[model samples]
Target: MKPAKNSPRARIVRYTVFGAISLAVAVITAFGYLRYEQRVDAMHPALTGIALQMRHDPAAWTRQERDASEMLRDIREEKVAAIGVSRDAILVSTQTGAKYFVTDHNGAFSNALLLGEMKAGADAPYQLVWLPDANLQTGMARWAAAFDKIRDLITLLMPLMLIGGLFWFMRREMTGGAQLLEESPTLRFEDVIGAGEAKAALADVQSYLTDPARFTDMGVRAPCGILMTGGPGVGKTRLAQALAGECGASFISITGSYFSAKYYGVGIQKVKHLFELARKNSPTVIFIDEADGLGKRTDTGGGPAEAESNRIVNQLLAEMDGFASNQGVIVVAATNHPENLDEALRRPGRFDRTVQVRLPDLEDRAEILRFYAAKLTSKADDIDFGQLARLTTGLSPATLAMIVNQAGLVARKAGASTITAAHFIEAIKIARIGDVSGAERALSEEERTRIAVHEAGHGLVAALLGTGVLEEITILPRGGALGVALVTKAQDKHLYRETEMRNEIQVLLGGRNAELLVFSEASSGAAQDLQEASRIGLDMVSKFGFNVDGNLFSLAALPAQYAGLQLKNAIEHANVLLRELDDACQALLRANEPVLRAIAERLLESETVSGETVEQLIREHAAASSPSMHLAQEPAAA
Candidate 1:
């Protein structure tokens, strides 16, 4: 059997062919250059000193008669073929096809005559009148010119040849590199954790891939393309592979970036080849990951880049439309940004169905956690999936997996036999904020006191206002924060009430308010707290339309003519609302100053305080202060 195009043997053969061609070109170029050099040397023979003296000063030859005899002897020894003299010139010819000429003045050659000036009976300038082989010299000069031209031509073509070869190799790879899985993916529907709705949406696709003839008989067309849209790591690609595995069809996966190349038309070729391969396999599933890389093309009348993009997109559309619905070739593509794709690709008869793989919900998160936890050699029964799911609200499936894996790693690092709740908790902290245990900075007593107070203030206020369940509050530094107070809700919330938003803003301001009340001034640590509080206040006023005036006009809906004035009003209203909230927050903290101080002192002692401990502290302080006065309870479900 022929070797695969990308196999080592094939690669070696391909490279060898290219290498041989390059070597041959190099050899020819070198040979031509050497030959040209030889001809050049032959064309210009070296002259002797006497020959040079005769040419420059012929009269010196007559003054030095002995020197003339020596010149004759030297000429005879040097194989000078002939010598000619005229009234104003003398010429010497050599047997090896070289000729030298000298001008003679003062009638230096009275008896001698030039070849052109010689009569039939005139005495000859020399004993012998020989002609150099003009034909041989002319031929050799022509040959040298030819060799020089050949060398220059080869030198010029070398780079072009190499570039052309490279383009060919790249084009071949780009168009043919996408390999179908030697064996179909084994990831079935059961293998995918979340994305129930997405799976349900793809049920028909699964059925058709299993039995295309069943649909064909009923004259029903199977979905030719599926576009899975979701945030990254939401299991879209896995779901696609599952669809293929469910039917045991061939799976071919290629990223959208695979089609992009610097060479013109290479992308188009890749697109065509990809679809063609899928069709040939019949009952094949083509999964293109990160399809947004080949997204909507913008026409700025730009040059080749824009044109190439347009062509690639156009080719993709054509391929999708060109295939028949019953061809049993389904093209599944996943993209984080589905809106960026070309409209043509999303139209009917192409990627007609767009499946949204949303983030896993509470129940789904619980299921996913159980699925991953079951695979680990841990106390899976002891692990509370519900609590873990609640703690990981809004996290993707990938992050959930990472948390479980990290938990196992944490357990292993502790030299524990099985994972435990405490290990998982530590893992959660590491995953959420990052492992900053080693990053803790040495703080002075005063700064440590301030950090403890700041974090304690946040926890106390959150508990007092029932914003959320305080998970943990710590004076220990993590990430960029000198202190952190983590609060989690009882469950995920999709909507919020005006009072709840105000309560959240208060919780954000709690730290800063505590610093101000305790130290008579706030520190720079409140910068993030102030920014977050300001953002919530502004959103409430401008976006949520939660102003006191009861106006429902959103900032985004404001008329352009009134936008500036309305926005100014919104900012003023936000500022007024924040001041009011700040005053209320400070008052609450002042009344419960004992409780804040107690929490801060506990944090200073242990560097960390659990939510239950803070709540106990609050209850103790409230009861000690006044038996009749009740502390705020957790807010009721909306």
Candidate 2:
């Protein structure tokens, strides 16, 4: 029995055989034509020499030249047997078995002499005849003849070429289904450090891919797509890889940007082909990174690029919903910009499952740190992973890995065998403030003193106010700032209390206050501090409902044109609020002036101070203010 012509296997076999045959024919035809053309070209110079010789001295010519001249003089008058044609000459053989060369160029005589010696090795004598342009016209006509033959060959194969291309494209589109199917996963779900919830969600997906029958029995359809959303470096793409790895399915990874084109239909064709491949390879995981670029909302005002994007998006939607049964082709797409993706793409049928791959929290960061730390070898001591995690409160898993890798490099550069607490600390500072060591920002004694005073004020106020934990204070210049008071929350907080927010405002003003107290004026160094304070203050009044009225409204939701009025009102309210806070801040600073001066002195001496040292100093000052007293025994003696 013969197989059906339209069957997939039959198509593959037919096209494979057809392509092989077509390739062989093309090679043969091209080879024959090229050989003929080469032979014609090769004989032109020899023929030109012989033709010139015949023209200059017909009496000196051999029997071949005399006979050839008659034939060559009027090439169309009689049928002259010729080997080939040239642009301006022809090579012909006489009835007497002699060879003759002909040309119209006057310089052919000199060239003919050279060709005679070169071709003399063949032991064939030839004559040169210089014919007029009129006689040479017939020789030039052979180029058109050659072109005609080439055109005919091309005409013969053009249809076949087109058919072959269509067949190859379709085959690729069909077989593209599962470019790879892994019997086992190279990366398991456990390998991904964070995204526990996302990992759990994908576990069910793996079950569907591995055993769809179990779900099918329950009348549940497998989700066609899972959209992983998060900020950049949040491990969204890595989770996609882990999903494929866990499921042991074929992985076809492509970027969303791959399906965008300047030309129309190209992108749509690509999208169709991709889905066709996935359908053929039923148990396949298609991972698209940066999917927002491929599936952006269509533009109402259409252009070529816009039209192409819409076509691709439409094709993607069709493909996702095309299969009647759960084909086990789970598309895992990752995009940092979920809001930019088309609404249809995020709807029920397409990317039905959305997993938020957020920044790793404290516990997640600790585990992630340990995972990366284990990859390092020269560790003299066990790192305080808890302390490292606390320092990097909002850092991504990727950033944590970087810190660990950078710490190893730092330790190696210092000729240390193991990564120590100090190495990690330096790495954190480097990650936060950048490498100031390379900048060579040497400050004068007076300038260093002012920077010390400014940073000391920030650290002292933050410690006193209990707004945040003062990590470190440095007078060294880093990241365009003359100094920095590194303060961080002990843990990540999604919501800030009113007192905490107020204290933050005070802390921001500390640097400016310190400068005012010491120099009786402030410098441009407080620009960032003032800007941050203003933003927090304004947000308190406008967005957070921290004003007198205690009302919350979404200022961000307002139109841009109307925002100016709302923003002005917010700024007015904030100013009134800050005025009141300013008095409290001034009074607090005045009472803690001694502590501020003490911290500043220490900073000037050491150029840096730890958080614990600042806390200890504040505690000592507090204790001294209410010194312990002993009973007066003198009264009893009297």
Output the number of the TM-score-best candidate: 2
Q: Indicate the TM-score of model 2.
A: 0.72
Clashing pairs in 1: 88-104
Top candidate (lDDT):
1
Computed on alpha carbons, the lDDT of every model, listed in order, comes to 0.80, 0.75
For candidate 1, the lDDT comes to: 0.80
- Could you tell me how far off, in angstroms, the CA of residue 338 lies in candidate 2 after the best superposition? 1.0
Give the Å error, residue 593, model 1.
Answer: 1.3
Looking at candidate 1, the ten consecutive residues that score lowest on lDDT are 130-139
Q: Write the per-residue lDDT of candidate 1 for residues 72-149, one digit (tens) a residue.
A: 554647566555454443455555645554434433542443333558787633333222221211224457668999
